[model samples]
Target: MKRVEGRVALVTGAAQGIGLAVAQRLKEEGAIVVMSDLNAAALQEAARRLDADAIVQDVASEQGWIDTMRSIREAHGALHILVNNAGIEGDPSAPKDPQGAPLTDWNKIFTVNSAGVFLACKHAITLMSESGGGSIVNVSSIASLVPTPFLTAYGAAKASVQHLTQSVALHCATSGYRIRCNSVHPGQARTPMLEALFERMARQAGASVEQFTAAFVAQIPMGSLQEPEDVANLVLFLASDEARYITGQAIACDGGYVLAH
Candidate 1:
């Protein structure tokens, strides 16, 4: 049988980037996927690409989780996997401290990145328990493990996600629920978000984008940056029966960036 044959999965932020890659990987492993994002047009486009059901939702809202679960129940009857991948990098506002970051920026990052994962897990666990258990993969970041200078809020939020995953996993295990929870930490991948950051860094350093990218890559012991699929492959493994024994762990797909740096 296929790795995830007959399974149903819900992936948040599935319109693009890491989420999109995870959804595709899950589908390839034989799971029926349902994806959601705040970007309606992008979600629709991603849906078309995967031929999967897609919903537009603001993941930061409590009602959005309720509605998303309701839709999944009505459409698929039961869900076997939940991938909490929705997050924001916060607004480009000034820092509040000597570094110049703003409080509003921190709030925005926490709301979507940390609180959103909490809400999704809150609802998903309820449903998963009823169905006799499921697997959850919370997409965190390498920032959670290492110190990130400018993106303090983002790092903190992802760190919360890692802790939350462990908390949920321990709860389920102790409470006799079969559900499993884990977090995946990805490093700088070649997504639009990374591109934007690279552009900024390139301009700041008076270098071309390629030059800045090479400089960044030089820090990784692996001598390269990771691709979205690099993270997706790990997610796919976690969602599969092969990972039935794994839970409450934070796996990093950073191409040695954490260690090298």
Candidate 2:
């Protein structure tokens, strides 16, 4: 109920999926939200629909964060929330050469997933510290905690994000800043990315998408997949004053999927 009222939030990759859900949730809770994404058209449309500010950007670029922070300062006066949610699925389930991936693939994965998060946190801390501190939530994945075949690069990148959150939190604490940093790991959420992944798996296994989904769901003790809103709810809490004392932790909104195996 308006827990984030009067706050200013910037959500990267806000064109769709979990990022879009988080932006909407923050706005609904009364925060002035700025949505950014690489897809300019989609970002514009989403911003129009949600009535939030939009910035088309490649989060991996250093200048992207600079321009974004400048815009935020001009429009919102200060930053209160930064949700680093931009990422890519990286390589396909079966690559051309599974045993030996190209260095390009590895670099691209780390560039967007890990480097983007670092850039956001770096600039966010500067603005947040000036404004009496803020909150930062880095969206990680359950793959970071467990073994993930064919997604080695993605898993490694997310693992770095988890540790990055802890380091940022500790630095802020030691510096006497009120800012908080944490990571959220979601497993098998029903987003477009997951849908495409399921479809790919279905084709590879010679099964229908529904069948593949059902089989996957069976592995989760909760017997269900999470929705983007479910993760967004937790993000809202962490962005709000309710989670003021919480920082430097990796929390899972995985519907018990991570524990099933």
Q: Which prediction has the highest lDDT against the true structure? A: 2
lDDT of 2: 0.91
lDDT of 1 by residue, 128-175 (tens): 888778899999999899888767888989999999999999999898
TM-score per candidate: 0.96, 0.96
Candidate 1 clashes between residue pairs 3 or more apart in a chain or in different chains = 94-100, 95-100, 95-101, 96-100, 96-101
Every model: Cα RMSD to truth: 1.4, 1.5
lDDT, candidates in the order shown: 0.89, 0.91
Q: How many Å off is the CA of 141 in candidate 2?
A: 0.7
